[model samples]
Target: MTALMTAELAWYATGRFYRANDGSLADYGYFLHLPFADAPLFDGKPSETSAHFTFAATPFKADGIDNGALSLGLDPVGQFSLYLQRRPGATFADPASFAQGECIATFRRTSLVVGTTVAASLTSASGAILGTNVFSARLIASNPFEFAGKLYDLAQTVGMGITQFGTAATTPVAPPPPGYDLVLPFTGSAIALGRAG
Candidate 1:
């Protein structure tokens, strides 16, 4: 998908659960919003505002983990990086889940590298550093397709890592968070769209 290098790709990821480093579990839910960019009227045709795709979270899924956005970048020479953000929402259905907070994940391909992908930090809305995570991602597919003049890929991915209750940045509190030291195994699929026409 070299075409993705010059364009911004919009993607969505979802998994069944968030397993902590210590072997606990929390519910996982996801949402997908389509129409990455504005499609304007052309050739005297009407704008298609009603054509869209959305996936609402199921009742069994935790609330705060509802919406997620993903950005994947792959360079010409075969390097890749990804950024994922999940917005916080209502109370958690699974008490094992982390406290309501805005979570961000940043990871890079490590196949040719020496170490694990960079660690990601989770922070509360209050700006307090919650915890940190270290994980590695594997791209399951690279086949690309075109839709409405845009390039698209239905990519599958898998990850394994640990989420510890404290950050390596500074002194962690006396007692770690609820899901501290939990093992995390992830399986996700994303609908990626390239912006370049």
Candidate 2:
């Protein structure tokens, strides 16, 4: 388990994200889906063997940077939209902010019955083109295990990733391109069933 957690792991998460503008939620939210889980088949086979995101290394590194920013190494080209949040902020923050990144993962033991709590903060500094962004997550280990002074849990991890952008001026922008800044917020849970090669 130490090797798995310290090395690489694949996460299978089922969550939803909603787009809001001016604090008003959308009439309907959208569900998160694997990139090619339901896409056109090629050569009578699926595009990817697994839909889960593959981490090159653990996110709980001493520095908390992970093998690569979140999973930037997984898809450096950004073709899969693995980290679309970086798209608009390319100028403001490093594309691989998750690596040696501001995000921090920690584990603390509570009790055998209650389990341990795993949490991390997702954040980035101001970039040349974008302002700072913030997000966080917490996971409880219903059935906990300890390793190297750290607790490990394979239960459902729930958290939220939210960030707002655009002019904060109450007045509307010129006369086009919507009247307010864009707010992209998503909340959901992910489960780490096992590691991925």
The estimated TM-scores of all candidates read 0.24, 0.19
lDDT of 1 by residue, 61-127 (tens): 1112212331111111122222112222322233223222322222233332111112221222122
**Which run of 10 residues does model 2 get worst, by summed lDDT?**
71-80
Q: State which candidate has the highest lDDT.
A: 1
lDDT of 2 by residue, 1-197 (tens): 23223212223222111112333211111113322222221222221222122111121211123333231101011001122121122110111221221112222211111101112111221121211211122222134333335443333221211111111111221221242233222223222323223
| CA lDDT of every candidate | 0.27, 0.21
- How accurate locally is residue 163 in candidate 2, as Cα lDDT from 0 to 100? 16
TM-score of 2: 0.19
Model 1, residue 148: C-alpha shift (Å) = 10
Which pairs of residues have clashing backbones in candidate 1? 20-182, 20-183, 21-181, 21-182, 21-183, 22-181, 22-182
